[model samples]
Target: MPTKPPLIHVLHPGLFTTVQDLGRCGYQRFGVSVSGAMDPWALLVGNRLLGNPDRAAALEITLHGPELLFEQALTIALTGADLSPTTNGFAIPMWTVVAMQAGSRLQFGTRRQGARAYLTVAGGITGPMMLGSLSTHVRSGLGGLAGRAVKKWDQFCVGPAPRTAAQSIGRSLLERYRPRYTKSPTVRVMPGPQSDYFTDDAVQLLTSSSYRVTTESDRMGYRLEGAELPHRASAEIVSEAVCVGSLQVPSNRQPILLMADCQPTGGYAKLATMISADRSLAAQLAPGDSLSFRMISAQQASELFRSHHAELDRILPPCCS
Candidate 1:
């Protein structure tokens, strides 16, 4: 057999690390979850730094980041939470590309603010895609490296960097490109298909109460603890397809926001759906963090989503150009 290509080995798996791309869409009909990067913004920014496509698979590290030893030279970028990343005792800049030599060690410390960080390699991390995506859905064993969290001694191969010279982004662009973690996020929500099932007071509480994210949260869903939302209908609704940001209200009246790894369908009555634009923001929320939802009309939600896409266009260079 031919000798296998060299691969970067995981020295320390940090808090949580998973392989993610844009996501596995269009397979929901087959009951596959759209598993993807939790912090899509970070994933995109990191990819751009390395001149890679937005949909490329990268490593999504949560809370504490990972430490790896590269088997070959490669260009990489880090975005999202500041885990105080350093390479072989030298600090690496965030939202910018840096070159890593073979055998060099990369380490990430505890996070300063947000929960997840996205690390993108130049040509993106090469991996087998299940259901057309490399995103890991541990619960269902659908994608990624055998469908689970990255393990120590696991090696990953990276492709070559772009032939064009790496361009440095201006400080102004850097400031504009990064995600804002300084302020608490106010997520936008749309009244659900079953909103009328809940009392008006419950609707008020859903928007007014400050809910703290419980430690029970994960890639599957965010379990919140706060004011109970009273549903006028005591009976269960038939299970239906659930998407990212579906706020499902269980029998106890507590809301759980379904996430990237959530099941394709759900039985719980959904009270609201967070707009697609804010899904990335919702993913950065950690346990003990407080969040509030503001209701918006569908028309307004569509406009906001368009505006976000426009902003992304401004940052990324044209594909054909």
Candidate 2:
């Protein structure tokens, strides 16, 4: 018989903490967002450290973090933002496997870096799957703790762990696989489908100007305040497909960086789209943080993606991925 899974009690729910998996796919056509971990690389690293599947559900602690009480001994991992994670008032290291004793209290304090953190257990957090994913989209309330953030006194459990699985205790992620995030990160971008709708000066301004993320930003998209990219005529365009990382410029001229939970389609003219390689860095930025864009050719973008994908592939064993 298989060993039963362990439970975790939520002592206090942090600001905007939610359960997330990779994301929902193939349902965007019907108007669904690919709401998942903003920093997927970090989430994957935490999961890999705990010997969980790449898409295993984990807690996406945004900006703030929660206090958790373990009912039984369990092994877990932390990654992404350095939220000053602690256990029983002692600091615990991120990007490594950590063993917790029964009744241990895991808490987080001042954020040292990045905008979000991920906590992963050996079997990953168990949650209801909607649209083939366990991601939580607050507005739609589709998945996760009943389609919302974790609440105070909420209880969670991990999936059943394989009895034959090896104990990956003390495992630490290497630096090469970890994405270095900073307050101002310059991400690479490719021209958007409506690139022709903007004037040449607009393109120049976009690449040359620095943008600050406004507090109004959320998981849906970022309302950036920066050099206004003037359009050739109007900002409106036919509602079309838009994906995460889309840099849409409206009549206001300031760019809007679409993120997780962004609408499947948008009408504003998009100037560029951040490349997949740099999306992780963009995801780590918070309100008031600044960022710039560097234009790259489509071919260059593909090359960068291949190189980045190769790096992620090395984070775990073949079977683990």
Candidate 3:
């Protein structure tokens, strides 16, 4: 008798779960939103732990994690938010690879800390990619399991295990690489293209005061409520290309920190952009989380980005396959 292919059956879909890679690049020019993993760094780290490509598709589990039943033996890695993962009702640690037996059940308990988690199997998630990415843009119905969140009874076909002869089982990340989930996270930012439109007071308020993430927040953007940042001139700006992390302020003065699913172009005045190094951290922030920002020079931001990737390269498992 022939054996069935490996399958991950979803018993219960958690809150806002989706399949995401690094996101669809080069499509923003055509007005396509780059809907990818909110915490791309976590996704990459999970993939690297499994020796998969940096951008292989993985399950982006949100606030309330899902309940899954494995139908075949497999190796997996969990990264990003600590949602208290458990296999066969036993606790499992994050940032480490673990092997699971067939028929084992995976579940997550109350969110102890952090808001997102990435689960990567030894082989990547087998799915169709739209615009070169397996990311799911829920609003437009683009990619990943018919462009929707995995639901109850959904069965996902996982790829083959690591092709390498020597697999790094039980491997773990160093202390420094492990993510820290806190109530108050200080995010770094750089002046945006429309920084000058805001009054000096607005910029100062942005850096000096603490903002609370609002319930309205989503993959599109994080709506903050705090000190109003008044504009020096008209709040309207030419419909210009907008990037993830753009801090857009509308007439109301509250800043909208755009995220992975933001529109390709926006018309609001952008005062600053959260630096790439901190956006992944920011992605882990949840509603009511106290968030603050620190401004950094352009050179400093560039160095941080380069340094982050360099550090990942150093810690990533060898791609023997």
> Per-model C-alpha lDDT, please?
0.81, 0.87, 0.88
Backbone clash total, candidate 3: 0
How does model 3 fare in lDDT? 0.88
Could you tell me the lDDT of residue 165 within candidate 1? 19
Clashes (candidate 1): 0
Q: What's the true lDDT of residue 174 in model 3?
A: 77
Candidate 3, after superposition: displacement of residue 168 in Å?
Answer: 1.9
RMSD of every prediction: 2.4, 1.5, 1.7
How do the residues 1-321 of candidate 3 rate in per-residue lDDT, one tens digit apiece? Answer: 756668999999989788888899998888889989999888888888877777778999998999999998888889999999999779998988888789999999988878999998887887887889889999889989999988999888887767741275787787786878787899999888888998887778998999999999999999999999999989998899999999999999999999999999999999999998898778998998979988988789999999988877888844643
Q: Which stretches of candidate 2 lie over 4 Å from their true place?
A: 1-4, 162-166, 318-321
* Residue-by-residue lDDT tens digits, candidate 1, 184-262: 5779998887887788887789888778889999998899998998888762688888888889888898899988888
Q: Provide the TM-score for each candidate, comma-separated.
A: 0.93, 0.96, 0.96
Per-residue error at 158 for model 3, in Å?
1.1
